[model samples]
Target: MLKLSNETKVGILTVVGITLLVLGFNLLKGKSLFSHNKTIYAVYKNVNGLMPANAVQVNGLVVGSVSNLEVKDKDASQILVTLTITKKIDIPRNSVARISSDLLGTKTVQVDLGNATEYLQSGDTVYAATDGSMTDALKEQLNPLVQKLQGTLSNIDSVLLTVNAILDTTAKGNLQDAIRNLNATMRNFTHTSASLNGMLDPHNGNIQKTFDNLAAVTGNLKDNNQKITGILDNAEKATGALANGNIDKTLQQLQQTANNLNQTIAKLNTTDGTAGLLLNDKKVYNNLQYSLGNLNKLLEDLRINPKRYVHFSLFGKKDKTKPLPSDTAAVQQ
Candidate 1:
């Protein structure tokens, strides 16, 4: 009976040990005590900061953990990473994986379920990407600025040395004379400014009259403010009406008018129409010159012999006009 009791105790302990081992395995796989999960693989170029057992996230939520990492092929260019995520995560077939981190180097695998209607199956491989860290970017951006600042500081030092040399040279020369001249100029400026202030005093009648004129102008502007506002309102309404009206039709009409004007200008540039002939041909210009010459000749004739064109008659009979005796005597003399 004692041997049977010892055998039963051993069996009970063995069964408990087996149950504990199963629970530990489930916890290590990141699963519930009774649930199952799916495994997927992704490959990366440089998993520099990534390690095994790092959490995998989808949209910043922890969904899985890395299970294994190894060289994908004989070529060490790519590294393979296996993830054991929950079965609830429906990763797409064309989903991508990338290494991400916070401000610190706390790395994780980020998954992107791309726009695939079909979901990823177990043992499917995800596309991998690598984005560099912000520290590298900041260093790259600051390098040139630091170099420029150093160059600027060197230039400033050279400029300061040259300025000091010039100042020392000036001090050894006629600097005292320059200082005296400056003092004299300052005194003259003070006197001139006092004279100007006296002339511009507010109590002066001319200044008072100028202020009164300005006040009158401001008063007039204030009185006309309503009229100005009304004009502006009317202009705004006209602009708004033009904008809200058939603007496209108006633009079409304007285009048609422009086309007609262009046609007219083209005709004027050619020798086909009357205006075109006048503008482009020389015959019309010659005719105009000839007509002007004839007009001048007619004027000269009228000036020389006005009696031929001008005639006078008395009320009852045709008047026989004769020159006055004094004008005739003057002509004879």
Candidate 2:
């Protein structure tokens, strides 16, 4: 048996302990004790709370860890993140990578195996599709709603102001008068209704009898409806026949009469017709005026010299009798 010094035993124990710590650290880094790490690239628009040393997973299995994050090009609007993963995992070429969060709110990089036959080689770029965070999604959904709510509030304010103005105007002017008139109208209506109720009291029996009579008349009309319809149909057919033949002839006669009247009116408007002469001729009016003037002059001569034309003697005392001058000789001489 070899004898070991205490210092040598402590040194050996320290070496073993250091070796175990190294192996544990490598295991925690997602690397086997002797396995090599494969470098892969992940491109993202937003890292979204991801950092280095965060685990990379594929189908919920830990495969790698995020190594670095760097902006590839400021103008390109992209971020390039590098990852060191286990060589045993075969990431497909068309695989998509994304940053996701656990239920406990820890974020990590996740790989989605795409439909590709070949696997991803070292330093291959994995296209990343960034998912909107809960906050981002809520903002996206609520922004338009907030805008609509703002517009609705503005419209409601406008409506309220308009209603207020209308109420103010109504209260300032005709509202009281309208209320008084409405009250008076309501009172009058109440009185009239009371009077009508008294008039239609059950003790009177007149209203009930009238309604009963009306119902009976309506029932009788309903019973006679088909017969009345048949009679009306027959009367309508007869009237239609009469209107189609005799009424058409009568309308033709009336049209002819109207045309005759129109022609007569046209003739009366002519200058040579008797009515047209009466209406349009000035010589007839002048002759009438001259005849009227002569008649008036003759009437005046008769009124002034009535004794020359007629002599009336109450007493018959004749001293001499002389023959009246011959009327024709006096006129000619």
**lDDT of all predictions, in order shown?**
0.82, 0.81
Summed backbone clashes in each candidate are 0, 0
The pairs that clash in candidate 1 are: none
> How high is the lDDT of residue 249 in model 1?
94
How do the predictions measure up, each by TM-score? 0.42, 0.49
The top-ranked prediction according to lDDT is: 1
Candidate 2 per-residue C-alpha lDDT over 1-333 given as tens digits, one digit per residue, 9 for 90 to 100: 999999999999999999999888756655565768788998777888777788988999888888777889774468888888874878879999888876566778889998888988898888888777767777999999999999999999999998788778657577788889999999999999988887687666568778888999999999999999999999999988887787767889999999999998988777777678766778876887799977865666566556546767678554333333343446679
Superposed on all Cα atoms, model 2 deviates from the true structure by an RMSD in Å of: 13.3
Give Cα distance to truth, residue 158, candidate 1, Å: 4.8
For candidate 1, give the lDDT: 0.82
Segments of candidate 1 deviating more than 4 angstroms: 1-34, 140-151, 154-333
